[model samples]
Target: MTTKKTSIIKVALLSLLGLILIAGVYYAPLIQRLYFSLNIEDEASMPENLRTLHQYYSTHLIESSATPQPFPRQLQENVLPESFQSHGETIKTKAFFTDAKPTGLVIIKDGQIIYENYWRGLTESDTQFAFSVAKSITSVLVGMAIGDGLINDVNDSVTKYLPHFKGSAWDKATIANTLEMSSGVEFDEDYSRTDTDMRRFQMAYLFDKPMEDFLLSLKSNREPGISQGYNSMETQAAGFVIRSVIGERSLSNYMHEKLWQPLGAQDNAYWNVDGAGMEVAIGGLSMSLRDLAKIGQLYLQRGRWNGEQLIPESWVLESTTPSKPYQMPGRDNPLSEKPFGYGYLWWTPVDPNGREYYASGLYGQYLFVNEDKGIVIAMYNANNNFNSAPDWWKERYEDFFQAIAQKY
Candidate 1:
């Protein structure tokens, strides 16, 4: 009740308020990232979210080259077929595109842009998220490292480069096993489930937990190289090895030097980084559709660009080929998650000719290359209902791509 006590109480309250304001300012970025991660995707806000995701996450820029190699436009008339076979039924190709319009689609055949279209307000200049297609990008970086003699071989144990993984489940895993999705790491990749290991990994990224720590905590359910298992963590582990072998150089910097510049990328790319500034190698690359197609083009040329071997020819061949029986593509194949066979972070369709392979991501993002036909298709979609969509939807898209390739 005393005047002195009242003034003291007011001062104490003000001091606490000042501390709260300071804390809020200090942790504003983390709070914003958390807010973005926790909210459900509103269809109305999806476009802006895709465009501005870099603002919510830390990122490293992949600067474009001075001499950009833009694909020459030779737009085909009625390039897409009327229909394609899916489950022995003729599905209209136009209907497929109408039902789930992608943000952008770029079809390159014989080093020419034969077909290019945009929907959902996406432009050729606008960079879209690559999602888990980034795994294929990471694979190329690893191949480059091997070619440079920085990494001894694909068969080498991951721990050979990343000593931190020694004595962990990854100690026995080879770089090849990780690339083939055969690391046998016990990770529940079911996205529909909240309690799955994939969700735990996402939480770690959202909460600014070190990705390496989560990877280290994982244990193997089956022996390494036994069968194909889709594990994004395996790609992250390969990324870690890349960062380690390159010494003090950052992964994004190395990517720019080895990949972007060599591919003569027209636009600067963005690789999303975690709290500690480590690139999210499993997913999180964003670039223009043209530039993304350059990835396919590079591999299509067997890693040679501008008369230089950016990635070794042997590495390119090995990356696309399914060497193991368990990695073969089949609907009833017990070893793999999807019907597509696993390669070195690439998807091998069961083609008798051994011509085509692709880099795919969630929500319909794909970088497809038909080597024999000299076709490369780069598609970016905002298929929010992708998880719930019929399994044949993806297969249908594959058939359409094949039809285009055959026509070309």
Candidate 2:
């Protein structure tokens, strides 16, 4: 071959290699997280839960071409709770140093707004991601379905609704078990770098395959219902049971009719849809923080709103009360692990003076309700340190709640 031809061939090969390198870097996990925070709509390869969540917020929560509903207001108050003011200062300091953003914070006491704040360029009008806070919402919907006779009972096997799971490990699991996170399924919830089971699950859900199929593919790590383990996939299984009970309706539509419209939500919200168009019920909901507070308010009033019983009063009480005794499942149970216990998609703090439970999520998302004091506090943060934040924030929130309780 001629020298000139050889030189040209070598240059062409090098150029191709460079292009491939650039693409890999752009698609790396860190780059993906950065890209998702900015251009969420275009990043379609995210976890099915996240992708659906983004689609929901973009399409329904915003006041844009797709959604035209005016924000609704059940009630509004101007007074700032003294407790919230003091706690806000502490949270602000912690958040600034930890590379996290607080999207919104709200406190409701005695049916009046005591405090409200927003950071990170989010306003009362902007909808923020719920992370796993959506799980609590799903839990509420399950209660509603039970009240309406759509769901027969919590003890009913999941196979009753989802027959595809009839022969699987889930067949022996009850709806109540799943809600309590005691389904005994061996699934990992870690989101660290590399190919974890969670990553595999995300890939499958995002790529448009059946979540049920993916779930059934999991092997049992423990005997069914022997212990409690926090597994996001179990929540997805709960969603499947809900879908089975209310066939032919979208999760968004069901939520709209049962909760949003009835509770008079200030804004429309969205649920991320899977490849089969099923809402990613595990943790794919997005809504304004103020509106999110309204959800907590509904529970505060025992599921009653505007002289109507939106959810069964009995169901609400049972759902919030801890079902299991306080104990750790694994050997390395962190001190942050609650000794108080867990309810239906809610976490109870180990406070002896006052009974407090909350809908909690990774990255500092919380909807804390203290029935003893008639207080409901909602907060959203973008912290990624799920393990550390829960323990640390619980203490901060308890202190905040105690100060507020003294006033009442």
Candidate 3:
């Protein structure tokens, strides 16, 4: 208990506190991101998280055009059907929304809004997270890149643009393969498992780790272009390829210039970025439901918007068509949840007419297009059971969308 010994102990404690303070200061942003990444999908807070995702992550702005195009509202009366058949069972339309937990729903026919609804305190102005629908956005950007001559061809090897991936898993993969989710890069898309690769990828961004590092370090589980497997990392690689070709520009900036502005986006969009400022091309986009419907409407119109061909018509056809045998819809495909075929970041239902395709995302986000009927349906939801939901649930929604299209 000597005075000199007590002073020495006090000095040690103060020095330790100083080091801790320095670490905290250095890691504050990362810690905050990690905290949000972990809690954003909590069952109780998911609705609020969907509404305010831009506030929780670092984002790049996809600015709206000066001349914003608005959807004309027709506002039909009692348009939704009473029931729809799926898996030979008739389900009530009201129960679909209850089960899906939709926050917003907009149905556009012939480029006019026929029905729009919002729940869980969401409004027309709110920009809910698009989840994996951003992948479809990235697909459109890729098509634009090809049309602009920035990218030589979709069949070009990814290493042609990204030299760093020359010896990586993507060495032999083509850009088209990545777009088709056939890159063979091993990434678990399952979100329920904490030990899965998807969880690790989440942690990578939460801790400010370079997403490219994680992407480049992966090894292919199978040969490229053999079959479809839902791998988000492949989309990230595609984003990197787009970044490489569009020199001196971020994906957000490129998308804004080539797609968002040209398409006449009404509201500003937000895209989450990794620590290295790379847009999370897998699933990061956020925008209002009307703007989301605009994406579908554009495709429904064959990639033309207001007399302008924003996306190539050829690309749109290729994006929705499954050319490969493995890409066909059946019970044999690796991830055929509901007998729907795989296209370039899009899904094709088993309709005999073969005119319907859509882009869907985690937690029940959908941007559906019925090309034959000229219908577009945009939906946002916070379904807690998305991971565990039965396969028939999605098919049921598809049937409902088609029913509405037929009714209109």
Candidate 4:
């Protein structure tokens, strides 16, 4: 080889070595975490991976081997064995079996489980991913934390509970602000943008480690409560704040004692955890179809279960009812939600009618409840068609349920 070529090779080797050294020193832990997580660019697993999310992550068990709440037998008059119509199309067991792509679907009416079905290799005993539907549960936990006096004031600075976030964008943030998605933290929740904050969050949470660190490093896009923003970090931050205040009472145990036991969940559940073993409250909850529906029924009854108020009635009302600028549609605020607005992590209709609300997630996980119609539907799906679906897509899915509601 020529002397010039030898010199060039030596220079290239040195530069690569320098890059390796820097990565090792600065991102050693993250590198190790990613090495255990995924492929190139440390990108999060795509929508396809959602089908087997429980298998992917190290999970913390939320067991319900303790007495599960029994469902009172009162099958609906217009059960699925008969028929239902959507947009003039007759939907039967076949669509739910092969077309609509549901993993499991449960329908409850007037406190009775009228109809239940499972498909896509799922059985009544199987547990499936609830994804962001878990955020609704996190919201419930926050309300409980408030009632428990662990968090005394929603208006107080969140940094008080989570001191590690001191001096950051979250320093002046309040619990209410985070709940409202108005924390103004610079988080890109746009599912379409691969480089957005949500993507980075997925990498840290699902693939890499130390999801909390990524949350703390965030800079403010604007002042707290000034503009609305949505991201998994808001829920994650809330989880941390609650965990810090609650002390050794871990989130998993708290859910079991306060929610699972009280609601009488049928079987055990699991929630995915991060590198530090904190519950991925943003997503990562797994449960059976019936237990998932029971949560909806709990809310439909305004947080009352078996004659007991598990969640405060006031909290349920506040969570279901859209507030402030959200009550008014055609909102032009950059951070304001279009089509429909949000209430306490729960999606609300544009009209602010307290009767309807939903908990939705990627790959077609949904919990749709129409209190006015006395209907609750929990659907688990693997919709290869629209896994990373946009908000408008979810809004349309509600219409499908509206049809079912009208028929019954």
- Please, what's the RMSD in Å of model 2? 6.7
Candidate 4: Cα lDDT at 133: 93
- CA lDDT scores, all candidates in order: 0.85, 0.68, 0.84, 0.74
Question: How well does candidate 3 match the true structure in TM-score terms?
Answer: 0.94
- Candidate number of the best TM-score: 1
lDDT tens digits, residue span 113-207, model 2: 76777765567766666878889998998999999899989888888888878767786888888888877777876654446778787767655
Q: Write the per-residue lDDT of candidate 3 for residues 1-408, one digit (tens) a residue.
A: 699999999999999999999999988877776777677768878998888888778899989877788889899988789987767788898888788888999998787898999999889878999888999888988988988899989999999999878889898999999988888888876766788899888877777688999998899888887878778888888899899989899999998887778777888999998889999999999998988898898888888877888889999999988888767787656643336777888887766244888888888889998887888999888987887863555666678788887775
Compose the digit string of candidate 1's lDDT tens values, residues 1-408.
699999999999999999999999988988998787665355656655666677788899989987798988888888878887767888787778766557889999889999999888788978887788999999999999999999999999998888878889897899999898788888888876799999988888887788988899999888988888778999999999899888787889998889888788999889998778889999988888999999899999999988999999999999888878878888898877778777899887644334898888777788999998899999987776676753455666677788888886
TM-score of 1: 0.95
Can you rank all candidates by TM-score, best first? 1, 3, 4, 2
- TM-score of each candidate structure, all chains considered together: 0.95, 0.76, 0.94, 0.82
Estimate the overall C-alpha local distance difference test score of candidate 3.
0.84
- Sort order, lDDT high to low: 1, 3, 4, 2
Superior candidate under TM-score, 2 versus 3: 3
Please identify model 3 stretches exceeding 4 Å from their true place.
1-15, 333-338, 390-392
Candidate 1's C-alpha runs over 4 A off are 350-354, 389-391
Candidate 4 stretches with Cα past 4 Å from truth are 1-51, 76-99, 206-208, 327-335, 351-354, 387-389
Please provide, for model 4 over 1-408, each residue's C-alpha lDDT reduced to its tens digit, 9 standing for 90 to 100. 699999999999999999989988877655654554443212233322444457656788888847767777666555543344433466564554354466677888888878777765777767888878998889888878777777887677788888879988788788777777788787877866788878777766755477778888998877877656666788888888878877787888888888898888888888888888888888889887788888899899998877877778888888766676733333464557565667777876544334788888766788888898898988887665553555555654565666566666
